[model samples]
Structures are given as structure tokens and as C-alpha cells.
Target: MDKDTKRDLHSLPKTLAELVGKHIVAAGLLVDEDPERAYKHAAYARRKASRLPTVREASGIAAYTVGKWQEALSDLRAARRMSGRDTFLAIMADCERGLGRPERALEITNDPAAKDLDADERIELRIVAAGARRDMGDVKAALAELQVPELKERRARPYVARLFYAYADVLEELGRKEDAREYFARASSVDREGVTDADERLAAIEGVELVDSDVEDGVVWTDVEEEADEAAAEAEATASRERRDDKGRDHRRDDRRDDRRGGREDRG
Candidate 1:
């Protein structure tokens, strides 16, 4: 490639600041499962929209997954400032907790600005706050943070799982082994199909199994049905072989009887 081609590629329209919002969204979606790749994409998006809050948020998420805690704190805080009261605040609290400053994390979540977080985001914040309190040796306060009203409702299984999982940690910390095991079991029940490390924690507590749900986005039902049908056909083919073996045993029995009858007739 020549210098002119490189310059043109670098100057592409999609690389421009004005058109980076959608790419930022895409970068966020990729961060959890593919952080390294997501980080590269987020970097490109940030180059185009460094001032955009979502761009910075995506960068922070990717960096956090890669264990770049300081970078995550900086980018997430910047995103929180630029976005002016976005979900990035809760995310930044998580970064604080990750860096072993749970008290600061709790303070961040309690900010009046964070009070209006949605159900899922609120639950997430509480989980982090609970951990921070636990780290601070406040076991009761940690459990209290996870005891929100929504946790008792079946419709809030995901949130409830998060609560139980966090509660289990506090229980374990306080040397309440049996209670911790029960809480861990409860967490496992609700966290099925989860991709997070909470599942592993639940398993360690006892009598819990992690069953991953395979729900792929953008995959067609028709394709799934075709795959199922193919599997069924293979199963049927195996059954057919078993039936043929049974038939071979019956044929051998019939041949043996005929030979015995013929020999008896010849003796007579």
C-alpha cells in the first residue's frame, strides 16, 4: 500500500467524529464477550468521537474486562462527566470496587445522581456496593444492600440471583458456611444461562450446577429446526442398526431349530 492510500483509508467518512455514535454502541455490545477485539474497535470509535460519552464508556468497559483498572477508572469517569449523569456512573463505581476501594464505590452509588438508575442498573450498583461494604468488614451492611424489594419477586430472577450471589459472599466472609451454601444454591437456580463469574461462585458453595443457555442473537429459528432434525435423523439411524442386530439373532435361532428337526428326522 502507498502513503496516499493509507492517508485516504485513515480519512474515511466512518472514521470521522460525526458518524461514530452507532459504532460506539457496537463496541459496547462486543466488550463483555470479546474484550480485546472490542477494545480495538472502541479505540477506533474513540478516535472519531473522543468527546462522545458513549465512546468513552465503551472504552472503559473494554479496558475493565482486560484488567486495565486505572485506565478504566479514568475513561469511565470522563464518560460520566461528559454524559452528565449517564449509566457510566454506576459502571465507574464498579471500577472503584475492582481497584479495592469499595468505600469509594459505595459513595459513588449513593450519590443522588445514581438514585435514579433503572432496575437492572440499580441491582448492579447494589451488588458492587455490597461487595465494597463486605470488604470494609461491614457484613450486615453488605447483606442489607442486596436485600432490595425486587429480590423477592420471581419476575426479578436475574436481579435476585445477583443478590443471593453477593449475599453468599458476605455469609462466607462471616464464617456462616451453611447459610452461605443455601444462598449459593439460590443464586445458582436463578443464574442459569449466565456468562458471568457468579455462576462459578455459586457452584463452589455446594449442591449447585451451572447450565448454560445457548441463545444466540440474530440466528434464525429455521436454522435451529434444521439442526434439530439432523440430530434426530442420526439418532434414528443408530436405532435402526440395533433393530438389524435383533433380526440377525432371530434368524440364527430359526436356522438352529430347522437343523435340529432335520437331524431328528434323518435319525428316525
Candidate 2:
């Protein structure tokens, strides 16, 4: 847990705090790989301490990962009300979009609390806002919404790559193919950590298709373990063949020796 979350759990009895912390840790560890299980862990923590903002925030994230949009919105609302933090502004808006309420998402993006968010959060909100506009079929408005000074940022922050990607997508929607490709290239250049699909998008614009070689021809990808097992099977088969050959040669030699011994006895 971070210091801020530890501070949030300070009000609980030590034993209760430890239990909640364990569940939170488990939820975090599983959220990306096993979202349903992660949500269950967060739900367990929430049942124990529903009033804590930290628990509610964790539950919100887990719920979001599992596409439980309404539940995610409820948890995030409770967390914000409890802590008065605007940290989840972008995610709350996204949950609104996920719930098929793009207008509500736009409303969240326009919320007065948006001003208090850090640079990264603010940019994420803009991205969600653009998505909401696109969802509402106002593609031009979506394009306009992404036209911010931060779009020109030279610094390679996570949000900068995302912003460039969002802008490129909007430009593509507006039929500005060249402009879209340019921004996609910019996004790919700054996305050193593969946080976005900007590289693939740029490749697509250049008439290139990016494919995973292992997934070609509808074949399932195999791991190193399967390859190793195949190698071991081949080695065992070679050894077994050698053993059979040696046994066959030894039996033939023994028969020849027996035949020679019979001939000598007959001659005597």
C-alpha cells in the first residue's frame, strides 16, 4: 500500500486493517490477469470496510476491469464522496460511457472538479470526453474537444502518447488521412512502453498488416514448455531405436557362433 492508502486505513483496528490490506493486495495483483477474481477480492474488502474511500476506490477499479460499469460508477461515486478526491474523474466518465450514457460521460468531463486534476488526469479526461462526443455521433465535436495545448507537448509522458493516439483517431474519423498518419507516427515515437497501439495504427495507415507469427493459419501459439517436451520425446525415440538395433546385432552374432559350434562337433 502507498502512504496515502495506509493513512486512509489508519482509522481501522490493526487486525481489521491487516485483513483489508491483504484483500486489497490480492485484488491489485490479480486485476490484470484475472479480473473476476480480483473483483471478488475487492468486494470482500468492501464488505469489511465499505465506508473507507481506499476500499471503495479499489472496488471501483476492480469492477471497472470486469466491465461492471454500474457497480464501478457506484463505487467510484462513494469513494469520491468519502474522500473529496477527483483522482477518478476520467474513469467515472468512462464508466458512464460503458453504461451507454455518453451524455453523462460528457457531463463528467465538464465537471468543475476537472480543474483540480493533475496534468495526466486532465489529459485522460479529455480523451474520455472526445470518446463521449464520438459516441454521441458528433465526430466534429470530438475532433474539437481534443484540440488542446497539451496535444503539442514535447515531453514523452504516458498521457502525451495517449493524447496523440486520441488525436490521430479523431483525425482519421474526419477523413484527414495524412494528418492522422502524422499524429499516429508521433504517438508511436513517444510510446516507448507499448501503452498504446499507435505503432500498429501507423503501420496500418502505411498499408502494412502487423501479425503475430505464432498466430498465423488459425494455429494456437505454443510455449517453450511444449517445445521442450517435443524435443525430449524425439531424444527418447532415438535412444530406443539405438537400443533395438544393438540387441538385434547381438542376437545375430550369437546365432552365428552357435552354428559354427554345431559344425565343429559334426566334423569331430
TM-score, cand. 1 vs. native: 0.63
Please give, for residues 1-268, the per-residue lDDT of candidate 1 as tens digits.
2232233334446546334544555666777777887788777777765665666777788888887888888988887786574576667788888888887888887888666877778878888888788778888988888778875645426767777777777888878988887777677667655623554565556544444456663112233455678899999999999999999999999999999999999999
Q: Tally clashes: model 1.
A: 0
lDDT of each: 0.72, 0.91
User: Against the correct fold, how does model 2 do in TM-score?
Assistant: 0.77
Tell me the deviation in Å of residue 118 in model 1: 0.7
- Score candidate 2 by lDDT: 0.91
How many residue pairs clash in each candidate at the backbone level?
Answer: 0, 0
- Residue 213 shift from truth in candidate 2, angstroms: 10
TM-score of each predicted structure versus truth:
0.63, 0.77
- Which 10 residues in a row give candidate 1 its minimum summed lDDT? 1-10
Q: Please tell me which predicted candidate would have the highest lDDT against the true structure.
A: 2
